[model samples]
Target: MTIRFDGQVALVTGAGAGLGRAYALDLAARGAKVVVNDLGGDPHGQGENRAAAQKVVDEIKAAGGEGVPNFDSVSSYDGGFNMVKTAIDTYGRLDVVICNAGILRDVAFHNMSEEDWDKVFAVHLKGSFTVLRAAWPVFRQQSYGRVMLTTSSSGIWGQFGQANYGAAKTGMLGLMNVLKQEGVKYNTMVNTVAPVAGTRLTASVMPQEMVDKLKPEFVSPAVVYMVSNECSTSGYVIEAGAGNFSRASMVKGPGAQPGMAANLDAEWVQANWDRICSLEGAVPMWRAGQTLAAFQAANAKQA
Candidate 1:
């Protein structure tokens, strides 16, 4: 079946360019009224240009879709509130939120300043919180909502010289885990996207030829579907780009328990270190309690 948004409204942060622009355009094309929000900052989160946002809104309108421009920084609580307010005021209600705004401060951990860390977190981690927190009430009130948060490979796995960015990106997973549970009863779904796309954020690090191959548009399909009513799964992490899509998840190994002895020591752990770190019998954990449950089950078996 073809997925569409019809009467739904969506708010896309950082809609001025790149992946955010691609997502906003696609969502609008699919019949959703979109709020194209962009602080219009440079790739490093500096400066502003109101036209950056208006241009996308214009594109949406030119395509015969409904949209409005919002020049608000997602890092600010008030900015996030106003972004949601613009959607509600213009389209009446919001059904989707795509937290795609971000800035880069790539530096080695030793060289990374507190300012760099704070700024990155403010835009990525705190920015996500600000917007989602504002939209949370509406989702609960309406009993239906869809959310897509942007994560990165740097955060999901690891990359040298990106401690701040990685930390902030990984934080999205934690947020998704809790929000998924809270929104389940309300019919709200929250999922994350770790997009491997060639955008402004990666232009400096990636080769020009590779950038041309990994278009931002290639990642939008998965993101759009994740935020559509047709998608019921929540708390999922999808990696998409260059027409490739895959699911990433947190898994736990069948850990060595070292018996029920109260005085389990470093020696016991050392003896079973390989077993403790082995992934031979690892299982994907869907919830936090599952890890503990697995441990209890293993203890019972030992008894």
Candidate 2:
């Protein structure tokens, strides 16, 4: 295959099943040594099973692919470090990491408890972060690495009974954003995907017909490409599922900005509310300095 991994090693979190399993198999089939990590937890982030990870590893080996099983949780720093350590100890180095481990605790904001909130955040947001922290050093030393964070439409848009889930999932985007920024210099790139499929997590909400249409393999392309050498994108949130792929972006529109000497009061905000939310022209992705420059340009003539 032209898209061969050759001698590379890929670490896939939650690889016991679902999209992570798909990714692990695909990479291994393409010649990568895979590290399959799974805490073997329930959809609510409870329980464990060494067999979940072991089974996937066995399958990879049976298919002529090299892989190791890891049962460490990603929510804690030590666990994340141990997972990475396993890859390094077994294969010498890592070329990719798909932080796809997650749990769902669906509840309205009013009814969501602190435990639910913390658990979701622990597995999806901080979990991804902890893994990256472990992998960053190895990536920098090698000067190459691919990272993909799993997000969701519920997190991207909105959904009832997903206050905890949405908050945690969306935070992955923020983590990817900063990782993208920091990784630019070190060549350790990071990106995100909001996937839809018939995983154990989504089997209840998504209809079976739709699930059949949106196979986990269809979502694998986005992950494979993003975590491959060919993909140069970072700080991006792409959506893929059911054989359709699209991108998500943060956009900024030119808004009504009063000059330096102009009043900065509720009246000003009230009057310019329309301008504030307008989207007539295409919006641009503005960086921190760019926003400052826009501010200066807007008030330049006034000064």
Candidate 3:
């Protein structure tokens, strides 16, 4: 079946360049009315202008797609509200938001400044939350919405010179998880994507061999599905790159227990550390409820 977003509106932050630009264009081409937003900042989050995102909007309109350009930064409450305001003012309603805005302020752990830490979080972590805080009520009223969070492998796996960026990305893993639980009440969906391509944020670190393999277009299809009403998932993180896609996930190990008559003790925990930390026979689960049920079942066996 064709995945079409006809009559839908999407706001994509950081849409001026890189992965954000690619996602904005893809949505517009597939019948979405897009809001292309960018602050026109440097890689370090230091500036603002309009040409970058505006150009993308012009391109979409030229191709017969509907779109508008917004130069608001996603790093503040006012800006987040305004971004949503633009979609409502122009397109009448919003169906999706791709929180893809981010910046790099690389420094050693000891040298990281308050400015560096705050700006990085402002764009990547708090930025995503601010937009959602502004949009959640509207989504609730409409009874439908989609949120796509931009996370990174660097954060998931850890990297040097990225303490600030990594912390923000990892925060999204938890942010989206909680959002998923909340979204279930209103039929909203939220998911994270760790993309790998030769985008501006990735160019220096990506080698030619890897670049040749990870096209943004290849990853777009998966994104389209996740943001569409067709997807039956939330609180999930999917890693896409180099023609390989996998779900990077968290797991609760099958832990050990002393007899039901005995209280849990440090000595018991030490003895069962292997099972508590074991990844062998690990199963992929999506929510806390599932883990709770599994734990209860394991406890019942002892009882």
Candidate 4:
């Protein structure tokens, strides 16, 4: 079956180039009225221009797709509100939002400055919050919405010299997880995408050949599906790039139960270290309170 967004509106931040551009183009081609938002800032989040975003809008227009340029920084609350307002005012409704705006401040943990760390959060983490919060009420009233947050491998599994960026990226998952539960009844799905595309953000870190292969085009397909009505799952982290797609998750180990032991201490944990850390029967919890069952089951089995 063909996936189409006909009559729906979408907002893609950082749509001036790379992954965001790919997403906006793809969505527009598939019949969505797209809002191509770009701060047009440098990799370090300095400076801005309206040309980059307008160029993408021009491309969409040339291709006979509907799109409008939105030059706004996602780092502030007002910017976020205006971005969504632009969609609603022009298209009358917004069904999707791809939070792809971010900045890079790569430095070792010891050398990373407070300004660098805070700025990274301002764009990647808080930016997601700002935009999503602006659209939350609309989704609730309409009872339908799709939200895609851009995460990274550095945040999921960690990487060298990206302490600040990694921290901000990983923090998005926490927000996604909570929103998934809250949005369930309203049919608002929240998901994360950890892309390994060769955007300007990765140009410096990756080899030429590898970067050439991992174009943003390859990653945009999975992202489009994530925001489309075709997707049924939520609270999932999908890793995509170079025509490969996979699901990533957080799991809990079935640890040894400390049942009825009133005097448990660090020594007991030390004694059962192997059993506590074993992944043999580890499983992913579907929700926040589900982990308590592991203790109950272990105690019951022990009894």
Which predicted model would earn the best lDDT?
1
Candidate 4 C-alpha error for residue 136, in Å: 0.5
Query: Each candidate's lDDT (Cα)?
Result: 0.93, 0.88, 0.87, 0.93
* Candidate 4 segments exceeding 4 Å error: 296-303
- Cα lDDT, model 4, residue 42: 94
The sequence of per-residue lDDT tens digits that candidate 1 reaches over residues 43-126 is 988998999899999999999999999999998999999999999999999999999999999999889999999999999999
TM-score of each: 0.96, 0.96, 0.92, 0.96
Tell me the deviation in Å of residue 177 in model 1.
Answer: 0.9
- Model 4 poorest 10 in a row by lDDT: 254-263
Q: Could you tell me which residue pairs clash in candidate 3?
A: none
Give the per-residue lDDT digits (tens) of candidate 3, residues 1-303: 388899999999999987888898899999999999999989889878899999999989998999999998899889999999999999899999999998888888899999999999999999998888888988999999999998999779989988999999999998998898889988999999998777766766778666656678777777888999789798889998667789998775555655567777888888878887887877766677896687678779887
Task: Write one digit per residue (lDDT tens) for candidate 4, span 131-238.
Answer: 999999999999999999999999999999999999899998999999999999999999999998887889898988888888999999999999999998999999
Pairing residues by index, what is the TM-score of model 3?
0.92
RMSD values for the candidates in order, in angstroms, are 1.4, 1.4, 2.1, 1.5
Q: Each model's number of backbone clashes?
A: 0, 0, 0, 0
Clashes of 4: 0
